[model samples]
Target chain A: MERVPVLKIGDILLVSIQIDMEDQVALQLQEDLAERIVATGVHGVIIDISALDIVDSFVGRTLATIAAVSRVLDAETVVVGMRPAVAITLVELGLSLPGIRTALNVELGIALLGKRDVGDEPADDEDEDDPAAVTTS
Target chain B: MERVPVLKIGDILLVSIQIDMEDQVALQLQEDLAERIVATGVHGVIIDISALDIVDSFVGRTLATIAAVSRVLDAETVVVGMRPAVAITLVELGLSLPGIRTALNVELGIALLGKRDVGDEPADDEDEDDPAAVTTS
Candidate 1:
């Protein structure tokens, strides 16, 4: 019964699941995350699953539950570093995991949470799309 | 002064934007979406933006706002049919439109919303991942 370590980094909780999680372990991680979020008062949680080659329905549901819980606690959860195969398997499993945000990697996940903190809407607006489109088309 | 027509099919509100939307028109669509969400009590909203070749920051922000508003009224919103070029442009412009779910096309968008309606968590679970892993790895 290995406990998933939840590391706190600059207002974000990083959970890198390195173990092949059992059902009980997934539930334990869920409980651990809720407590960590409340204790640290972090604004974001990045779950790095790059090492994971498989994600069944139970784990997928746990991730979604974690996202929903983190949202309630005012913390954004981003699942990062998902392999293409895992993504395909999840879709094939019919588990899209709505209410969850994802990033290609940890760096992008941090950027996404940071951008979300700047404003309610997405940031960095140049308003040049129209002008650029005019010349291209 | 073109109006974005929101069609009601089954329990979903389909907003297919087939025009070169002005800023005012985008805002109008936002208001129209909110009204339609409350008026029809649809379970979902499918915003089709495949027709538009370009999307500025204003339009992106409007889409986010629409998602937020529709959520408040208890309807899920999914943006569909985004071209690859438009996606690249949106990322370059720095607007990811958080809180809005997206699918590749209208059929997939409808499937996403339909799947969401069946249950709070994703449906269709066959827990053979362990057995599948047994042979592969």
Candidate 2:
């Protein structure tokens, strides 16, 4: 039974799934992430799965479950860094992994979480000058 | 004050914002949409913004607000058919409109909303032989 480590950076929780993501491991990660979200009072959770060569239906469902649980706890979950083949596989498996947010990478995931917060800012609601800082190749 | 019409299609509410969104009009649409969601007991909302040439910060924020509000009311909001220029304007204005789901068109938006409900479905969690029905250009 391998345990996934949950890291806290600033106000967000970062979980990078580096292992093979067995059934038990996936369930464990889901439970651990929920508890971490509550204990740390973090508003954002980023699960980087770039290292995963394959995301089966179980792993895909686990990610979607973690996202739903995070939402219920008033926290947001972003599943970033999915490989193209894995994405195609998930689509083929009929697991769209709905209710899950994604980004091309961890940096974009963080920016997306922060971007939502900026939307609620009263002062910058009318600010027309954003640096257009997001540049992806 | 012109009102944005919210049409009920099956179990979803479709709001096509064809008019120029003045401040009052946007606010009214927000309030109207909330009421309609409650009245219709629908779980999905599709906002069509394809006709608008300009989607300023105010309109963008209003869209975000509608999304947040719909989520609170247990309804998912998907903004569809946004012109590329409007999207560029939103990014440049620093209003990422986070926490909102988007689709390229109304048909895709419906598919996205339907995709989430399939996630919670327990029976097909492991089904791998899907037809791969989703074909996007």
Candidate 3:
């Protein structure tokens, strides 16, 4: 049985990975995320990776895949907290995440989930700087 | 009250932004995060910023500040889901996030939350990398 790395933080599932995260783990994680999204019926997800020493292109893509799956399952995904060194390495490696949602921290990610979709013409409580608020700015 | 840029998905917070992220916001966010940790009692934290076109020294420092607050609050922080362009720009601008946690995406970030506090121990299930096993390589 493949193990999907994650933990339950209240009703939300908090996934924090400490390994190198090669292709195998990424695939397994994607599958697990899909299943979990359906079972939990929870639209919120927080992915925390503060322990990795390195992240390659494959890892970045896999993360994006999970985000896509989450959306299909009617769940929202938030990628949070990052180390500066790893961030630099990933960018330098030219890893691009095209259809993924991200937040500066889990708190923000949760905040994102609460936001009214743009189609609804957001209320004044809207933050002008919000990415979703500004249409991919 | 000052409005912080945030992406809310349903009730979940996707991303929180303190753009221009001056020291004051940094301090406030620290307090905010601390309060949140105490309130939610959930130790998982993810910071995402695929929106910020540029991350200056102040922004870098602010992220570090948030990470510190999370630790003090007994919460784990992982910054994830940054674009390669933004990562490179931060790195080139000589802005570095010291002592902050980061991952390529939310899934990895979430995965990091469940890891042991020490060295990289293999995940209980997704450790097999043999050719016969799942292969995306």
Off by over 4 Å in 3: A116-137, B1-137
Query: Please, what is the TM-score per model?
Result: 0.44, 0.44, 0.43
Q: Write the per-residue lDDT of candidate 3 for residues A30-88, one digit (tens) a residue.
A: 77777776776666677765445567777787788788887777666777766678788
Q: Given the true complex, what DockQ would model 2 score?
A: 0.01
| Residue B20's lDDT in candidate 2 | 68
Error of model 3, residue B135, in angstroms: 67
- Model 1 chain B is weakest, by summed lDDT over 10 consecutive residues, at B121-130
Fraction of the reference Cα-Cα interface contacts (below 8 Å) that each candidate reproduces: 0.00, 0.00, 0.00
Query: Please, what are the lDDT tens digits per residue for candidate 1 over residues B1-137?
Result: 65665655557776666555678878888898889778877779988776567888978888888898887677889999788999999999988888889998766788899876433543224434435434444
Which runs in model 2 stand beyond 4 Å of their true positions?
A1-137, B118-137
Badly placed stretches (over 4 Å) of model 1 are: A118-137, B1-137
**Fraction of real interface contacts that model 2 preserves:** 0.00
